[model samples]
Target: MHVLWRGDTLQRLRLVSGLILFTFAATHFINHSLGLISVDWMHEMQKWRWVVTRSWPGTIVLLAALLTHASLGLYKLAGRATLRLPRWELVQILLGISIPFLLLPHIINTRIAHVFFNVNDIYVYELAKLWPASAIIQSLLLVIVWVHGCMGIHFWMRLYPAYRRIFPLLLTLAVIIPLSALGGFAVAGSNVAAAIEIPSVFANLKVLTRWPDAAASESLAWLRNLARIEFGAVLAVIFGCIAWTYFARVAGPKVTVAYTSGPTVRVPQGPTLLEISRMSRVPHASVCGGRARCSTCRVRIERGSYGLPPPVFPEVVTLGSIGAPPNVRLACQIRPEHYLIVTRLLKSETAGPEDIAIEEADSAGVEKTLAVMFVDLRDFTRLSEKRLPFDVVYVLNEFFGVVGAAITEHGGWIDKFLGDGLLAVFGQRDGVEAGCRQALRTARDVDLALDHINAKLEAELGRPLAVGIGIDAGPLLVGRIGYGESVDFTVIGNPVNVASRLESLTKERDVQLIMSRGVVRMTGWIPPAALTDQVSVRGVAEPVGIIMVKRGRELPADVLALRAEEKEKEKPAAWTAGFWGRR
Candidate 1:
C-alpha cells in the first residue's frame, strides 16, 4: 500500500501517459502529412481512424487517462494558494488552460464530422478546404499542444534518478522529434495543394467559411454530453481522491519550531529536527536533504541529550566518520519521541528561528575569534573523468570527511563545503587569535590527513591525490536568506573569495598550503621549519607571505608511517607557501 501511494509511482504514471499522448500526436501529424504522398493515402488513413477510435477498449481508456491527468494538474494548481510558485509553473498553468480551448474546434471538426455526418472522407483536403485561410492558427495550436505535452513529460522525468542522468539526451530527442514531424507536415501540405484541383466557387466558399465558430459549437455539444454521464462522476471521484492524497501526503502537516537563545531549539514530536527546522521557517542548511548523508545539520543535544534515541546506522556511520562528540547528532535522522532542546551548532537560516532570536542572542553575547581554513582539490576536472561516477562521489566524500575531522579537531566550525573544497571558519564564533592559530593548525592537520589519504589511494589504486589549502582572517556578514517557508544561513565576504583564490594558486606554486599575510600578522603562528615564502597574488596589489606546509616529524607515528610510504615512492613531493608565487 505504501509503495502504491509512493510519490514516484504517481510520477511514473504521469510520465507514461504523457509519453503515450506525445507518441499519438506525433504519429497523427505524420499521418496527416500523407497528403504529400497522395490524396488516396490520406483518404485511406481517414477510413482507419474510425476503426482505431472504436477499437475494443482503447478509446475509453485514452479518454479516461487524459481527463484524469488534466484534472490532477488543475487540482495541484488550486492547492498552492498560500505558497509562492515559480514563474515557470505559472506559465505552464496558463498553457494548460489554453489547450482544451484551442483543441476543441480541431476535435469537433474531425471527430464530430465522422460521428454525425458519416463523412468518412474528411481528410487533409476537407480540413484545408474548410479552414484554408486559418492555417496559421491551426499550426499554432499544433505547436502549443506538442509543447505542453513535452513539458509534462519533462516535469515527470525529473523525478526519476536514471532519467535525470540522461536528461540532455532526452531533451535533444524531444526537440528533434517535434521539429521533424512539423517539417514532414509542411512538405505534405505543399504537395496536397499543388496536386488538388479546386473549383473557383469552392475556393471562394472555403475562405468565407474558414471561421472556427461552427466547429467550436459542435465541440461544446460533445462536452455537454460528457458532463451529464457517469464517466464524469467517476472522473470527479478519482480527481478528489488524488487531490486529497496529494495534500495529505505531499504537503503533509505544517510544523513549526522556535529557538529562544543559545543553540537549543524546542520542536514538536514526529518530525526530525531538520524537518521541523525547514518546515517551520527556521534557517538550517542541509545540502543532502537531511538524509544523514552529510553532516551539514549536526546539532548538539545541550539540554535534553538523554531524551533522544541513539543514532541509527547511517547517522552512526556519518557521525563516527566526522568524529562528532557524543552529544552531537545529525538533525535529519534524530526523531525525538518527546519534546527536547537541541543546540544547533551549524547556524543556518533553516536551522535557526527568527532574526530577532539571533540579534537577542548577540545582545546577550559571547564573542571569540576562530580560525578559518579552506582546502580545494587540485585538478578536479581531470580526476572527475578519470574514475567512474560512483568512484568520483566516493573519493569526494572521503576527502571531505577527512578535512572536516581536521577542522573540528582543531576547534573550528565548518562553514560549508565549496563544491570540491572545504570552507572552515574558525574565529568569529570563538576568538580572533584563537581562530588564526586554529586555522594554521587545521592547515597542518589537513596536510597530514592528505598524506594519509594519498598513501592509501596509492596502495589501492597505484596513484596519488593532491589538494591545496588556504587560510585567511577577516570579518564576515553571516545571516539567513529567504522568508516564511525557505531560508538558508550562510557567510559572505571578500575574505572568503581571497581564501578561495589563494587555494587556486597552490598548484601553480607547487605548494599544498598557503596563508594570507593577515593571518601571519594576526596569529604570530609560524609554519613548520621545512615550509617556505611570500608571493604577490593577483588583485591584492601587494605581496602576501605564505608557507610551503609539510608533514612535521612530530606528527603521530601512524601519520608518519603514511608519509614514509609517499617518501619511498620518490615522486615530486614539493609544495610552495606564499601569498601568490608562480613556480
Candidate 2:
C-alpha cells in the first residue's frame, strides 16, 4: 500500500481540517453567546445548531476533520527535527496539546451521554445539572478551543496580504466573540441555578430531562473514568514519541555538513539541512517553518551533488514553481546522506512576509538593469552642530519628507537613509529606460524641493542647505537583503557603489548633481556643449565619463520649464474658494 505522507499534501489536509474545526467552534461559541438573553434563548439557538451538527452528514464531516486535524498536528510535532522554535510556535503547540485534554470531558458529557443514556444535553439541562460545580472547567474549554483555532488561522492567514489588511477587524471579533460567549454562559448558568431554587422549576426540569437511573448513572461514571485513562495513555504515547526522537538522535550515525558561511556541523543522518543548521546554531531562512511553502530556505550544493539523492515530487514542484536552478534545492526538504558542502541562497535574517509575493526569480535576487540614485545633504552637519538636537531633528525630518516625496512621486522607493543622505531605487516594475528617466526627473525635483524648504526655513538657518545628487543605471542584483528585523528590499552591485562615489565626488567638484554617461545615454538627454571631463572613481578600474551641473538653477531651459508648469498647475482655480466657503 502506498501512503500519502507528502509534506505539501499533509499541509493542505491540515489547513482544510483546521478551518472546518475552527468554523464549528466559532458557531458553537455564537450559540453559547445567546445565553446572555435567557436560558430559553440558549435552548432555542441550540436546537438550530444541532439541526446541522447532529445530522449524519455533519457528524461524519466534523469527526473526520477533528481526527485529521489532531493526528496531523501530532504528526507534525513528532516529525520536528529541532526543538529550537520561535516563541509563538511554542505557545501554539502548548495550547493545541492542552485543547484535547480540556475538550474530551465536555464532548463525552454531551455527545456521548445524549447517544448512550438518552440524556437531553441541551443548555437548560446542562446548566441545571453541572453549572455550579463544573462551570470553571467548561469555561476553560471554551477559551482554550477558541484561542487554539484563532492561532492556527493567524499562522496561515498572516502570509496573505488581504488577511493583514482586515486584521484589526478580525482581532476585534476574536476578542469580542469569546467574551460575549463567556458572559452569556455565566449569566445563563446563574439564571438556571436561581430558577432551580424554586420547587416548581426544579421539579419541571427533572421531568423534562431523562434523568439516568442508578445503573445508567454508574455506567456513565465508569465511561468518564475510562476516557480519562485513555487520554492519559495517548499523552504517554505522544511523550514516548518525543523521548524516542531524542534517543534516536544519539543512536544514529552522524553526517558531516560544511556550510559555506563558516559553520561545519556533525548532525544525525535523519534531519534535513535546515534542521541541521538550527541544531548547529547557524542562521538559515525558513519563512514557512520548513513546510516547503516558501522557497526562502533554498541552498546551493557546491559539492557532493553527485552523491545527493534526487528531490521528491513535492520538493521538485516547489523548486520548479520558483524557477530555481538545477544546483539549488530546498534545505528544508533534502536530507543530506553523506558529507556535503552547501551555501544558503537567501539571507536568513532578510526573509519576511513580503517573501510571499516574491514569485519571480529576479525578485528572489538576480542581476537586472535598474537605476540607482544617492542624495546627500552637504554642509548641513556643521550647520546643525551649532543648533539644538531637537532643532536638528526637526530640520532633518522636514528634509527627508520633501526628498522622499520627490523620489516616490517619480516612481522610486527609498532604500535606506545614511546619516545625512538617502538611497533610492527606480525601475523595479518599469523597464531600464523608464527607470533612468524617473531617476533624472527625481534629481531635478529634489533641487526644486530644497529651494522651497530653504526658503521656508531661511529665518532659522544662517544659509540655505545644499545637497549633492548622483544618478547611475546598470545591471544590479536587486532583492530583499539584511538580517532579522533590519531586512530591506534594495539593490547591491557595482552601480550602487558607483552612485555613492559620484554623490561624494559632487562635493569635491563643487557641483549640485552628477550623472554617469550611462544614465545620460539611457535618458537620451543632451547636456550643454561645454568642457566635459572624465574622473577616476574609487573601486573602478578606469575613469568614468560624466556630466556635471554647477547649480540646479543652471539646468537646461526645457528642464527648468517643468518647475514652471508645476507651479502653474498648483495655482487654485477662480471657483475653488466658493466650493470650500459653501461647505
Candidate 3:
C-alpha cells in the first residue's frame, strides 16, 4: 500500500481540483448569458449543458472535482495555524465553503429532479421554481461561486509577470458576464410571466407546470427536504470541527516566540509563528498566506530551536526548494513547543504587494539607482617595486584591511577587489540618498584609516600611502551578468563607467578624491564652490563636472560651513526616499 503526503503533491491536487470546479462554473455562467438572445436560445444551450454535465463522463469528473476540492479544503482548514488572514483570503475561504450549501437547493430541483422524478426542468419550469425566494438564493450563489473561482485564478496568476498586463481586460470580462446573465434572466422572467397570465396564446403548456403526477411532486418535495437537512448537517459538522480545534488548542502547552522586530508572542503549542503574529496583531510577511508556497515569512532561529518540532514533509519541500540554510525556517510551518527566538528575514513593516512585484522584477533583471565607487592605490606600485615580494603582500594586506573596515563602516558593499584596489557599491539595500551619503562618508573614513595604517607601517613603507577614490550615483542596469557558472551580480551603466574613468582622472588631476556632479545632486550635497573643474570621461560624449578634494580628508572652514548648511537644509529624517524609495 502506497500513500503520498508530499506538500507539493497536495498543493497541486488542490489547484487542479479547484480549477476543474471553476471550469464548470464558467460554463454555467456562459450558458446563463445566452438568455440575452432569447429564453429559447438559453434552452437550446441546455442541450449541450446536459451533454457536458449530465452525461456519465461529465458527471464523474464534476462530482470528483467537487468532492476532492471540498474534502481537501476542509482538511486544510482543520490543520490551519490561524483563521485570521487578509480580508480577500478570508472572504474567498468563506465563499468556497458556502458554495455547497448555496448550490444544494438548485441542484436538487434540477438534476436530482430529472433523475428521480423524471421531470424536465427547462427555462419555464426553472423560472417557476425560481420566482421569489429561490431566485434571490440562486442569484447569490451565482455571484459567490463566480467570484470565488475568479479570486482563485487571480491569486494563482498574480505571480506571473504577463498576468498583470491583461488583468484589466480580464476584470472587464468577469464583470460583464455576470451582469449580462442577471439582465438576461430578468428579461426572460418578464416574458415568461406575461405568457403565464394568458394560457390561450400558448397551446402546449407542459413547461409551465413540471409536476405532471402526484408521485413525482411528492418525490421532488422529499428531495428538497433531504437537501435542506444535508445542508444543516454540514453546517453543524464544520462548526463542530472549529470548536474542537479551539478546545484542543486550549488544552495544549503554551509557547513563547520572540521576534527580532521587538515583540515576543505567546501562543498555544499547536499554531505556527505566523499564527502567533496574526493572533497578537503583529505585522508579519506571509504573501502566500502561510501556505508554505512562498519564502516571505522565512525566519532564522536564533535560540531555543532544539525543542521545536522538526519540519514536516511540506515544510521540508518548501525550505529545500528555496535553498534555505539549516538555521532558517518558514515561520508559517514551524510549530514551536517551547520558547524560541527568531529573526524575520524580510521586513514586515515594508513588505506588501508592491514588494512582491519588485522581488519578481529583480529576479528578471531590472534597472536600479545605485552609488558606484572605485578605489585606486596611488604610489603603491612605485613603493612596492623597491620592496621584497613578501613585504609587498604584507603592505597590500594592511592597505586592504584599513580601507575594507572604512567601506563596511559606511554601509558600502565591496563587489570585488582589483589587484591593487577594490570596487565598492552602496544602495543595494538602501536607496539613492543613503547610498550617496554613505559613499562620501566612506571617502572621508578611508582617508583617516589610511593615515593610521601608514603611521603603524613606517618600517614596511618609506613614506605614507595614498588612495584615489571616485564615486558617482545614478540609474544603472543591476542584474546577473554572464552565462551559467560564470554569472556575476553587478551594476553596469554610464554611472559605473564614469566612476571608473574618474578614478583614473584622480592621478592626472592631482586630487586624493574626486566625484561626478551627479553624486552631489543625488545626496542633496552642496560642496564648496572652490576650483571645480570639467574633465572629459573616456566613454562619455561630453565633459563632466568634477568635485576635487585637494587636501584629502581636510576640508576648508568655508567648505565645512557649507556642508553643515546642506545637512540642515536636507536632513535625512526629512528626506528618506530618493527615487525608487528606501528599501
> Each model's TM-score, in the order given?
0.41, 0.69, 0.64
**The best candidate in terms of TM-score:** 2
Candidate 3 residue-wise lDDT, 1-583, digit = tens: 0111234666668888888888887777787788777888988888888888888999999888878888888777766656788787899999987887778768877888777767777777776557544667888889999899999888766645477669889999999989887777777766776776676634355544444477777876787778778867876787778778878887877888887656887778877788888877877877666767666687778898798768877778766655566887888887788888887665554345434543323223578888999998987888888889998898888888777666666556676678899888777555676777777777877888877888898756778887889888888875444432233455678888888888988898888888888877766657777857788887889899988886446643332232442454333321223212222
Worst 10 residues of 1 by lDDT: 574-583
Candidate 3 weakest lDDT stretch, 10 residues: 574-583
**How would the candidate models be sorted by TM-score, starting from the highest?**
2, 3, 1
Q: What lDDT score belongs to each candidate, Candidate 1 first?
A: 0.57, 0.78, 0.73
Question: Model 1, 52-154: lDDT tens per residue?
Answer: 6557576776676676667666554443322222344556666766666656556656555545644432555445543445566667777887778877665
Residue ranges of candidate 2 with Cα displaced over 4 Å: 1-7, 354-373, 377-422, 425-465, 469-583
TM-score winner between candidates 1 and 2: 2
Cα lDDT tens digits for candidate 2, 1-583:
1112234778889988989999999988888898889878878878888999899999999999999998998888877777776566788888898887767777877888889889878788888766789889889988988888898787666655577669989999999999999999899999899999999988888778876778977887787778778867887887788779878877988889998768788888888888889878898877667777667788878888887789887788767766677888899888888899987766665455543443224236667788999999998889998899999999999999898777767666677789889988777645677777667777877888888999999789888988998888888886555533333456788889889988998998989888898887776677765625688878889899888987655666554333432443222222211211111
Scored against the true structure, residue 326 in model 2 reaches a CA lDDT of 87
What is the Cα-based lDDT of residue 546 in candidate 3?
84
Q: Which scores better on lDDT, 1 or 3?
A: 3
- The alpha-carbon root-mean-square deviation between model 1 and the true structure, to one decimal in Å, is 18.8
